[model samples]
Target: MLTGQQYKDSLKDGRKVYFQGELIEDLETVPALAAPLNEVASGYDKYFNADPDAINPVTMAPMSAADLRDRIPVITEMDLLTNTTYQSLMTLSVAAARLEAHVPEVVPRIRAYVEQARKDDIRITECITDAKGNRSLAPSKQEDPDSYVRVVERRPDGVVIRGAKLHISAAAFGHDLMVMPTKAMKPGEEDYSIAACIPANSPGVHMTNTTYHPTGRDPRDFPVSSHRSIPDSMVIFDDVFVPAERIFLDGQTAHAAVFAHSLGLWERLGGVSFMVEQADELVGLASLIAEANGTAKISHVREKIDEMMIHATLLRAGLEAALAHANSTPEGYFYPDDMYTNVTKYQGASQFNTMVKHLHDIAGGAVVTAPSMLDFDNPELRPYLEKYMSTGSTVSGEYRTKLFHAIRDTTADSFGGWHFVTNLQSGGGLFAQRLVTRKNYDLERARALALKAAGLSGA
Candidate 1:
């Protein structure tokens, strides 16, 4: 990873891409991209450079080695599927043991870029998810349009890109981008399968930004919602040129799949790690809310809290499982098991939804109707809301505030309220997980076992 200064310098690599109508350059000054750079910068300094090396000295080198690159993106997409499935299972078990060591390597590289961008005030984002045209069809089979991003022309030193990458988070806010395959591409989808990092200003690259308002971003500043609300952009790359060094995968469908799967495994682990913590936070809030509502001692409500606690435990178990069993590949760094990682994510999805539902259930209608703190602070409504919202028990004013604010944020803002939707969708969405899961699991063996016991059929 480059230093913060170097990272900022790297953002200036001359690349042309269309944004709006005219070409834009030097993203540091882009008005629309300022806040995001700020947010990313804050995350980097605190998280990335916390260690002496500004990277994880203990585990980074071992984890950040070029080993993962050795897994060719050109491998058969079919094989990539198997490896992804396997890796997911392994990672879910003990994600921390395997991944924590590498944070030094991963964080600094990502952080350095983000930090410098923060310092220079340049915009940058990553694009991986494809337009994926028709849900039922593959990237190559989409009708009437380009559902997936692909290469349109091949230059000796670079390649021209076309099509759109959908649901690309932070697209509009970036000055340059790192694009890669969202999933394995099928044969004949070679153009779409090429993966590379290109400038956001690459020729013909356009972004349709989204806003997940209310809870997403700072709503006072952004107001769109649901695929909107300034969430992401539909990155349209039209004949954009990508030089070779910036190219990570080119028509190497097989290797692309491996790379994607590997990334997916790690992403699943990390995502679950964060999501689990989020759920725990909600659960803790729920308890406080219950106490304020004079329902803390209720048997059923306590039971729900217990269930929520179990979710955290299970989530940690999966994370630890992934880490405990991780191994290093020729790529030098480590990758977790597919089965455990997927299981962690899968279970997480199910449990998180379940947990949230209980939160809504326990919270009654109050979660949605609680008085805003602002309103409660008002002179007139303060008396009324504080009186009505309060349980009139032994709860203090501070305790009541804590309870009300808990539900308010969970159901309020895009970032705060839509956590479930984001978690379910961000990591390839729920159904996509199922698609990989079915491919990864050995259904035949299970079927054989059932048949043997029933004497109906056998291999």
Candidate 2:
């Protein structure tokens, strides 16, 4: 297994990585990316340190029937799912199915990819979303056919691809890029149906990263934001070559949508898992902030906290139900129950804004207006700031303001904005989930039950 430093060293391979207008030569040395890089390293550590019972001792894969299952819960019930580990696992599952949907000749490619990834402990970023120049036109109909990643040249030994995938999480930090089509294609649009795995450092594969990083803040002031974040990037493929062994889908237009469909389900499951963690954090914050503000007994505060509990409870129930009824696909990969996963994601996302608003309302304007820790360190202003910042007699001004700063970092800052938008839009938004729920639900059974209740079963 690759150690944290070993994983970091592997990124030195000559791939072009740019952030904030400057090309980054080495990720390990960059201060701006340090936190996110550490997060990725920790994910590697988890795989190495995972208990043998929960993971395969020899292969380092999860022991669950759902291959690549998020093992955060398996190791310690306390750890939250890390993006790199969970997402790489999700991509593995998705890539496995892409080949399973293809002809028998293409099936061995996915098995080989999985074996290599597990053997090397490679991190992967699933690259799906294309630049998609025009919304109304399909890939072949668009003025720019290169809007989506496609096969530009086909050689006997390999295929050359060119395009860009946007908002790819951890693309720069990962070892492999699981390239897949974002949308389905028609019979004539075979070029857009391509799916393959390319080494992140492969020639012509470039990554330009963009992410929210809170700078120059004491860890006490921005606890969560100061650590544990992943960088999202636009991964550009400029005539990158994929060997025959790495190509899962070439021109199979009929099965083009399989990658997206499979990944969507797995991604939503990841969303649900993370929401459980978020809900727990939000609840703890609400309780502590309420106590610190001396509003613990207020009826409205009590009601809002109860509402938060309801959201958390229902989402957790959905996750459990999904696991209880998880279904296995033809490829032998297990996915959470579709209806339950969709409802969990949709409701959790729908409630996110409200949860933030409630935390802000309970904590008051201090969440946004809290003075920087720098002022607290000023010898002259420290005394005066401390005197005015305290709320209850027992609450220290430093502690109170620090809590408020943490709140701002979570709910009022750029990081908070990212959390809100990603939570709602990450799994294709609420409407997409609703569509899945409607399609998967047993509506006919419900109608039959209703007819029986109304004494019209025979009619």
Candidate 3:
């Protein structure tokens, strides 16, 4: 496995990456990209630095059944969530193994790419969403064929692809990309049914980055945003050639559908795993700010806290339920209960706005109008600001300001706004989650129960 510095140095390859209309010559040199790059690198470091007992024998990395079984925090405390990056690698690894059980035509090649990824210890960002020009139309029916990423040229040795993939997180930082069909393909949409692993800096591959972090803020003021920011990108493939061995599924529509199903299961479970931590942090912050404001004893304040706690608790339960009911594929990869995973993700996304509302209620206006960290540092304003900001006598004025700033950065500011949207849209959004839930729900059992209750014959 590569060291953190080795991972950082790997991005020096001449990939065409653009940010805010300007070309980025090197990712490590860019401030906005560097944080997430470092974040990804830390995963490699964890594997290299971990004690032998922490390692998972199957993946040859430092994650465990307990780490996942316990549903440990992934967002709030960076040090504790040791297997965050390995989870992504494992998702695709298990995906390849699972796909092998059903799609024999493509499994061999897919397995080859999976083996290479494991052997090289490649850090991969899964790229599934294509830039569809029109939502109402299918890929083949779109006004432009480029709406969906497709193979334009099939060569004896490889295939050439041209199109764009959007909302690919950590695309510019990772070593490799695992491309899959965004959705199931129809009979005529064979060209869009391609899944392959391409080097991030492969020739003709370009990326334009998007981030939520505001520039030039004191790290103390925008603590969360300033410290770690993961940027998404629109990865364009302009006649990029992919070797035959790297291609997983080429013009296989039936298999492509299975890939989407399997990818969603793994991706949603991963999202659910990480988001439980976000909920935990939010709950803690809400309770902390309420106490800092000296309103913890108020009945209404307690009720609001209860609401947030309920959301957090229910989410945790759903995650555990999914894990407890995990199903193993014939290939030996265990997947979370599909219904439970989708329900957990949907519940989390649907309640995000309400959760933020509860947070805003508990935090009050202080979340938005809190004095800047710079103001607190000013010699003249320090005492005055402290006097006005101070609450709950025991809570230091500076500490109160920091808590409010944390609230603002995470719940009310632009960075917080990004979190809101990301929560809703991440892991394929509410509609997708609902669709999966509906598909997996046990409707027949419900129908029989209802019929028996109505004094009708149970069919």
Candidate 4:
């Protein structure tokens, strides 16, 4: 619901953070992180602000003055399509906001500003994870004072925050960032139990430029990792202001995860949906690579491609099942099936890794050691690399190498490095998904069915 501009202006006040030992003054205007920030802003613009008809559909029947203000949007296209998009983005925005809130440089006040956003628009990002420095020691057990962002000042108008937030995305360019306990906060750890929205350009804020891929590779031989990116960062918040209105539940350790889980349904569904769409592309891309290399006719390649297709299709079916069996909650939101979403996510994560590896197998060693496309154009080596690199007939050997290199950049180094890691970390870990699935198991229903089949209970 929040526009890109509204999101931008809200972050005037600075929050505290450290990156490379220096503070980031203007996050939105920064060069390295600017594109992704703008990408998120542009996505927001497509929502209720400009393309309501495309996103949210409503009847435009002729009515008196009383009805003019009440209409949400007119149903220009089919109502189903409109609702479908809005719901899809509703899920996406939830995820986006969660992603935005983590970077210290993005939002001014982490909590108060976001409450204002709820009244105004969809300004949500995941302050999902802390640096988790050791991955061995827990949040409360971290070594550094700045390891986990904590409250340092509680003013009359707002609470001041200190420490750093980590591995947050779009926080450098979001209107509001959602800050919450990275994991469940305990009673003794209430200081870390927070779920608030803050503006992007807050005072005392800072962010570091962290990338695990070819973030800015050029197009001539553009690296593939640069194309399909999932950005992540560690945000530091040092004594930042979070006004009262923006505070949802501070130090309520019991409810920290609950508050986070409350808004999670839309995002979980959103994650599943994005992976489903991307999986389709991944499968297609794999097929194209196989075909381009003449291995399309091979039975092993065919089976591998089939496996990718099956995984992708099952993910789609999972999304539909979640949608079909959605349940309403007191929060006025509809939640999709957690089991199905988790199943889709778990399989999707593992399958994506598998698909990339299979692609490498089909692509041969050239997927990694292939000469850079730039080398092909070099007068000295151009003829040589191209002369020997041919794999099939259609596109030149250089072209084939280009395609395979793209795959390598993605599959080679951690699936686009930070991006793949970000996806794994996005909606909690794969382990977390397994736990949720276990919690959602309908054991009583299974027991009842078993008893009925055994004639121990009435049918």
Candidate 5:
């Protein structure tokens, strides 16, 4: 396994990464990329350096309910790249199993790839969302056929693909890119049904990156995001070649959706797990700020805290159910229950804004308009501001202001905006979650129960 320093050194392998229109020659030197890079590097040193004889829990296949349950805390604490790497491996495992009966030839290839990735201990980021030129049209019907990544040439050794994937997180930093079909494909759309694992530094691959890390601000003022932020990339493949061994799916339109659905299942499981953690964190923030504001004893403030506590509990219950009812593949790899995972993800995402709203209502305008920490450093102004800002002896002005800073940094600023959108859009949007929930729901059982409730049973 690579160490933290080794991981940072490996990115010097000539990957083309751009930030703010300037090609970044070294990611470690870029201010915006430094925090996330360090985050992944630290994760490698922390998790992958255990005893060589023991199985690395991050990549281990869950064999039972306890195994699945045990992964929750790790998943919640994992960095973005590490978590995505887990999702990538699990997606391949699930897809390979689903394809065993239909396309047995790909099974061994996938298993081999997974094993090699584990041995190498390299980070991988998934590239699934396409440029998707027109939302109303299919891949082949778009004005630019390259809107969706597709195979343009098939050589004896490999295939060449051309297109772009949008909103790929940490694409510029990972060692490999897991490319797959964004949606199901029809018969004539075989060229677009391509899935492969390509090197991040492969020729013709380029990434334009963007991040939410605060620029030119006091780190204390932006505590939550200043310490960590993942960069999203527009990963472009300009006729990138994929060796035969690296290609997991090619021209198999029938099984294209299998990769997408498989990825969705794992991704949503991770999303739901993170949501459970974030829900609790938000509750803690709400409670802490209320106390600092001396509103903890107010009935309405207590009610709002009560509501947030319930939200956190429900989300936790959903995650528990997903693990307890885990489903196993034919090969004995266990995954979270799809119905519970999707339903919980949907409920958490749909209600996220409302939860934030409740937090904001309790926090008041100070969340956005709070004085900067630097102001407290001013010798002359500090005394006056402290005198007015403090509620009593227990709550100093700086103490209360720090809580406001946390709230603003997490929910009212750039990082907050990123959280809001990602909470809804990541692991597919709320619509996608709804579709999966509907598909997995036991409607037949519900119908039977309804019939029994009415007087129409056996009629």
Candidate 6:
């Protein structure tokens, strides 16, 4: 495994990464991208260097239910790049299992790739959502042929792909890009059914990056996002070549959905786990702000806090349920229960906005309009601001201001906006989660119970 410094040095490869219309020659030098890059680099050093013989939980394949449960804390603390690498490997493993019975030829390639990735200890980002030309038309029916990433030429050695993937998180930083079909494909859409692992610096691959990291602001003011922000990229593949060995799926239209479904399972599981923690944090913020504001005892405020507590608890319960009912592939790889995972992800995402609203309502206008930390630095103004901003001796103006800063940084600013959208859209959105939930739900059992209650046996 590479050390932190080595990891940073690795990105010096000729990857075309753009930020704000300027092509970034070195990611480490760009302040906006540096924090996350350093974070991921440090993660590598922390996990791999701490114990060479010990298995890093980020890359460890869960073999049993206990293993799945044990990975929660690690997953929660993992950087976005590390977590996505885990998701990529797990997606491939699950997809391979699903295709083993039919497209057995691809299984070995996937397994080999997973082994090599783990051995190399490289970061990978998933590229699934395409720059689709039309929402209503299928990939083959789109007016523009490059609407979805498809195989443009099939050479004896490999295939050449052309198109773009949007909203791909950390695409510019990762070592490899896991490309797969965004949705299921039919017979005529074979060209679009291609799935492959392309190197980040591969020829013709370009990434235009965007980030939520605060620019030209006091880091203290952005407590949540100041030191941690992952860049999302519009990754364009202008006829990128993929070696045959790296192509996991090619023209296998029937099994195209397998990668997507498998990825959704792991993604939702990770999403729910993270949401459980985030929900608790939200509750803590609400409670803390209420206390700082001296409104903790108010009936309505207490009720809102109560609701927030319940939300956090339910999300935790969903995570536990998902773990307890973990499913195993034929090859003995364990993944979280789809039903519980999707339901919890859906519940958490669908209600995320309301939770934030309660937080904002409780936090009041200070969340957005709080005096800057720099204001407190001004000796002349400090006294006046403190005199008016403080509620009492216990809640100093500085303390209260810091609290407001945290609230604003997390829920009222750029990072907050990113959370609001990603919470709903990540892991394939609410509709995808709902569909998975319905598909995995035990409706037959509910029907049986209903029939028994109505005394209509075999009606």
TM-score of each: 0.71, 0.90, 0.91, 0.74, 0.96, 0.96
Tens digit of per-residue lDDT, candidate 5, span 161-188 = 9999999999998999999999999999
Write the residue-wise lDDT of candidate 1 on 205-232 in tens digits. 7766444334323331222232132346
Listing every candidate in turn, what is its Cα RMSD in Å to the true structure after a full C-alpha superposition?
A: 9.2, 3.2, 3.1, 8.1, 1.6, 1.7
Q: Write the per-residue lDDT of candidate 2 for residues 20-134, one digit (tens) a residue.
A: 8788888866665777777667656666754432432323333344543454354323112234444445555655655563466776777677766766666777788899998
| Local lDDT at 354 for model 4 | 77
C-alpha RMSD of candidate 3: 3.1
Candidate 6's residue-wise lDDT over 1-459, tens digit each? 888888899999999999999999998778889988999998988887545544455787888899889888888988989999999999998898899899999899999999888878899999999988989999999999999999999999999999999999999889999999999999999999999999999999999988999978999899879899999999999999999999999998998889988887677777888899999999999999899899999999999999999999999999899898898888788888888888898899989999999999998999999899899999999999898789898899999999999999988899999999999998778888788778878899999999999999688
Count clashing pairs, candidate 5. 0
- TM-score of structure candidate 2: 0.90
Model 6 residue 214 distance off true place after TM-score fit, in angstroms: 0.2
> What tens-digit string does per-residue lDDT give for candidate 3 at 1-459?
567788678778888888888889877677787767777678667656344234323243223345445333442344212232344555555556666666666666665666666666666777888998999999999999999999999999999999999998878776777788898898988889998889989999989889877667788988888867888889999999999888878897876766666666456766787678788888999899898999999998899889989999999999999888877655455667888988998898889789889888988898888889899889999999889888847988899889988988887888888888888898788888888778878898898889999898645
The total of clashing pairs for model 2 equals 0
Superposition error at 327 for model 6 (Å): 1.2
Q: List the residue pairs that clash in candidate 2.
A: none
How does each model score on lDDT? 0.57, 0.78, 0.77, 0.59, 0.90, 0.90
Residue 181, model 2, lDDT: 89
Model 3 spans with C-alpha error above 4 angstroms:
49-105, 457-459
What is residue 257's positional error in candidate 2, in angstroms? 1.8
TM-score of 6: 0.96
